[model samples]
Target: MSDLKRLLKSSGIYFLGTALNKLLAFFMLPFYTKYLSPSDYGEYDLSLVYVNFFIGIFFIDIYVAIMKFLLDDSYKSIKNYKEKIIFAGFVVFVICLVFYVFGFYIFLTIFDVKFAILLIFLGVITYIHTIYGYICRAYNFSYVFVFSGLFSALIGAILTLIFLIYFKFGYVSLIYSSIISTIFAILIIDFNVKIFSKFRLGFGDFSFVKPMFFYSLPLVSLAFSYWFAEFYGKFCISKSISLAQNGYYAIALKFSALLLLFVQCFKMAWQEVNFSKILDKNMMSDYYTKAINEYIKFLFLGSSFLIIAIKIIFPYLIDIKYYEAFIYIPFCILIYVFIGIYEFLTNIINKINYNKYLPKICIIYLVINVFFITFFIDKIGIWAVIFGFILEYIVACLMIMFLIKKEFIIKIKFINILYFLLFLTTSYICYNLNFKFIFLNLVFLLVFVAFNYRNIFKKVNLFNR
Candidate 1:
């Protein structure tokens, strides 16, 4: 099978899984908003923020290492590699647990009381699920991963509805739901150990650890810096504004994150395929070129559609109080677009072993984010954070592009740029026009879709074949 065919098949399955998961979560949103107060949800969201940050540190980018190792032909015995990977992952998970226990106490003193204990539990669960999920990905068990994810999400949604709506669990419901989901995923992973049994602990040469550590250390720092920038908005809102405001921002972020579901699913499949194929010198350049072009095209279209939908479709689905969050949707979608580009560029960096610079770039963004958030957020409110994120991503994207230009020259199509600008302008007008219903939104959606029909068709056909 062609690389493109494999990517499309995997991506399609991944998307199906992601879409089902998101749809389940989306249905539960109304229940959460109706039952849980903004403050309650805000605390719940903040716990996740901390969970993500700690996960980044504890995992130390070993997930990337697993992907790279699996794709490399050097590891002849899959069973041995799987065992080693699990052992390494367990060691890291234990270390993270110890840190988390002490960290939770300190965090409680500093942050909201509701999150301190909950986050620690969620963190451990997240760690196990993450490690197991990586094992699944390494073995090219995309369907297993996808199905596990959907099942977890479904279980979470059901549990959350019961706890929050029926049992009156309040903020605790979110944490419990997450724990249930992670447990479900881990169970599924354990059952599928045969697929990943090639990797065994104490079997692979310990020498691999040195190179893996060297490669992953920078990624750890990069993860920290990236999360630092991302979580700053929530942190600032929590400290400067009210928890209610933070809740509002979180809601906006959640909706905006839907746009990323597709991008992430694509990345998961694409990265593995790209790495495996890069060894084939025959069509490497063409593969890179085509992938980049398709990525840019799809991202632009996706962003455009999201911007339009935020204005028209989302209001009816979400609570009236959340309507204000629509303002941040465009900027948030842009952030994900930047992220997609960054992910693509990093493939080149990884290929060339220039991973050291990744952390440096992230550190630059981290510094910029702190300064910008501290200086501007009080004056301009939430938009300041949005603007700050845009600034950080723009810098990251440009830096990655400059560093990787020689290997993969990013040819920016003018038509793509024009459409992006047009879509942004149209979205802004549509947002401000105050169309009473979905009429104006429907009109703009059609126009945007019509304008990009040819490009859309090309991508669809490219993947369909």
Candidate 2:
């Protein structure tokens, strides 16, 4: 199969899988807004940000090590170190458990009793599912990987609704559902790969740990800084305004998940392409340049359509009190646009074997993000946070581009600028009209699609042929 075909195929499966796993929270917006208060959502969202950081920090992005060591052009490389990689992952999990025990009091002080416990459980299960799921994908069990996510999401959605509608668990319903679903995902991946069956209790080959940690430690720092920059907004919102106001910010984030649905799929599929093809220098420059240009075009086009769709449909689905959250969606979408680009550059960085600089870039991002939000939140409210992220991604993308200029000549196609213009126009019109100009918004979306359908769907069509 062609590289384009493989990319399309993998992206489709990943889309189906992640659409369920990540976008389930998105699809449940109506039920949540109806059942829970804004403050409740605020609590969950803040806790969620912390849990994500916890995974990145405590898990140490071990999946990245797995990718570096186990993923290659052939299965032989994976088979050689598979058990040891699994053992390394287990060792990391044990270390994280120790941290949890030591840090339990800190979490309790930060969150309420219910949320603190949920945070711990969710963190553990998410770490388990993440590593195991990555191992499954590393083994080329793409079908199993995709299906496991779908099944787990189905269970999560069902359990979430039951907990909310019947048991009245409120925002904690989301917590409970995620925990159960992740367990199912772990079980499914283990069933297919028999991960634990291949392992004995003692550390199998402690030799792998040194190089793995050497490769991953910088990434751990990068992850922490990246996460802090990414989520510092929630903290700003909570401090500057009420937690209920932070809930509105969280709602905007959920709407932005539309872009994330695509971003996550692209990241997973592109990682496969990157690791497989990075050693082939002849294919690196042209393939990466084309991939990025196409990526920008897709992200902007999707952002355009989503902004218009939200303008037309969002008011009805959400609670009246939370309607104001719509104002922030455009900024959130635009942030994801650059986020998509930044992630693409990250792949290039990894492909070029420049992992050391990642920490410096992310730390700079954190500093800029903090400065903007801290300086402006008092004046512009949540827009400070929004603007902080936009600036961060812009600067981060520029820095990465400069660093990788020799290896990858970054180019921006003219069509991508056009996409950005359309996205901007849609956002402006929709924000001003406030659901009043539905026909005009739809027209903008349709005309843009009509002009670029071929360019947009060219690679997508490869899957069918």
Candidate 3:
């Protein structure tokens, strides 16, 4: 099969899982907003940010390394490599556990008890899922992994609603639901481990273990720096401003993160599949260019929809108290789209083994975020956070482009820009005029779909022929 055909086929499976996951979460947003106060949701959101950081620091890079090593034929037979991988994962998990305990102590001593415990629990769950899920991906069982994620999310959302509405558990419902979901994911992955048992586990081979750790160490640093910079605004808000302000900012983030679900799934599938592809030089370059162009086009359309939805639908979904957050949604959506682009671009660097440059780029973002948030948050409030994110992604994107410019020429197609403008114009008119006509949004979406249909048909025709 052609690379494009394989990409489309794999993307179809991934999209089904991602779309259902996002739709379920989007449907539950109203329940969460209605049951939990903005402050409660804010604290919940803040804890999850810490959870993400901890998972990255603890297991994410190692998991990536596992997949990379598994893909390499040389390390495929290192006797105990699989056992060593599992052992390494256990070691990292232990280290993170110690850090979580100490971190919880400091957090509870200095901050609120509820927030600290909530974060620690969520962090533990995230760590487990990260490790086990990576094992699945390493064996090319992404469909199973994707299905597990969707099932977990659906079950989690249902339980959260039940806990909040029936039991009146409030914020704790979120934590409980997440814990249940992670546990379920772990169980599912563990049950599917027989598919990769052909690879033996050699506990005594320091040779195999050493290279994996060496390759992963830079990525670990990069992950830490990346998460630190990305969450800087939220971290600063939680510290400098009131929790209420943090809550409002969190709502904006929640809305913005809907776009990220698709991006995340794409990254997951793309990394595994792209690395597995055997392509000639010409084919590889052509594939990369086509991928980037399609990525930017889809990103722009998704962001345009989100921007319009925030203006029209978000307020009705959340409480009136969160109305102020609506002003930040547009900027947040743009920032996240840039983040998705940055991720897509970074695949080139990953393929080239230039992982060292990632930390440098992240450090630049950290400095920019800190400088802007410290100097401007007092005067501009939550807008400062939005601006900080915008600056961070803008700088990250440019830095990645500069670093990889020799490998691929990054181009912004004029047609994508034209579609973006049309979407923006229609969204503005409909939103401002309070057009109750559902057909207006549908018409705009259809027009955009029609514009892309030619390329879609061409790809399908290529496969059919």
Candidate 4:
């Protein structure tokens, strides 16, 4: 298959899986808004930050090396890496367990014992599921991966509903369902890939995977910085504004994450294609440029559609209590648009063996995010964090452009940026004007398409050819 065709097939499989997994958020939003109060939602969101923090810090992003080594042509046998991957998994589990036990006692002073226990339990299971997922992808078992994800999501959704409707378990139901479903996913993945069965304490040489661990160590900092940049806003909102306001911000972010359904799938496919072609210097720069240009076009247009659709359907999708969240949805969605761009750039950086710059960039992002929220949150409420994230991404993209100038350059067209801003601005205006001005938003979408007709259709013609 051609490169583009391969990318599309891989992206399509991942897209189907992620769409179903994330559909849980949209499908359950109504039940969540109805059954859980704003305070409950706020607490649940906070709880998740804690769980994610555990994974972010201790998981150490070893999956990065797993993919790199597995896909590297220099590697003699993929099977040789399996035992080392399992060893790395064991190492991650033990470290997390140690921290969880130590932290659980400390947390009891601040949170309920049961809540703390459940959160740790969920975190450990999530880590296992995530590692297994990486292993499946590394083996190129795309069908297996998709099936596991789909089944996991379906089971989770069903269980969550049963708990919410029949038992009225509130936010706890969400946590419980996730824990159980992820466990099922882990089992399904292991059954198909049999990664765990390769584990033997003495069978794999720790020295073999030692370099991978060393490579992943600095990425732990990047992961932590990213985690803080994201969840710190919620923390600031809870303390400076109100838990209820934080709840509103959570709803907006969940809605914004809908765009990830596309971004992540593309990233998965693009990463596969990009890494596999790293040794081929001839087509690298030109392909990267074209891929990003087309990606930005897709990102901007998809984001515009999501922004308008959310505005139109906001009242029906969420409860009346969360109507205040609509104002933040557009801003949040725009943040992810830049995030998609950032991810693409980071992939390029990784492709060219320039990953050492990622942690520095993430640190810069952390500083900007913290400074913005700490100073302006009380004045502008959630808008402070939203604006901070937007500015952080813009600055990060500029930094990447400078860094990549020496060797690889992905030239992004200015017109794409202009239309992105214009589409978003028009949508915000129409949304604020309510349903009466919806036609104006439609006009902007059409105008964007009309302006980009050649760029869009040219790709279509190429794909057909």
Model 2 agreement with the true structure over 27-116: per-residue lDDT tens digits: 777898999999998988888888776666655777777776677544355444667766876676677667864575476676554577
- Give the poorly placed runs of model 2, Cα more than 4 Å off: 20-24, 73-79, 110-114, 200-203, 278-283, 434-444, 450-465
Candidate 1 lands at a TM-score of 0.89
Ranking by TM-score: 2, 4, 1, 3
Candidate 4 wrong stretches, greater than 4 Å = 77-79, 100-114, 200-202, 279-283, 434-440, 443-465
Stretches of candidate 3 above 4 Å error?
57-60, 77-97, 195-205, 239-241, 278-286, 308-316, 406-416, 419-427, 436-445, 461-465
TM-score, cand. 4 vs. native: 0.91
Cα error of candidate 2 at position 222, Å: 3.3
Whole-model lDDT for model 1 versus the true structure? 0.74
The global Cα lDDT (0 to 1) of model 3 is 0.72
lDDT of 4 at 127: 74
Highest lDDT: give the candidate number.
Answer: 2
lDDT of 3 by residue, 157-198 (tens): 989988999999888888899899878877787777742233
Model 4: which residue pairs collide?
Answer: none
Rank candidates by lDDT, best first. 2, 4, 1, 3
Worst 10 residues of 1 by lDDT: 195-204
Which structure among the candidates has the greatest TM-score? 2
Cα lDDT tens digits for candidate 4, 285-371? 788788888899888888877777777667887999988887788788888888899888877877787777777877887798889
Clashing pairs in 2: none
TM agreement with the true structure for every prediction: 0.89, 0.91, 0.88, 0.91
Give the range of the ten consecutive residues with the poorest summed lDDT in model 2: 72-81
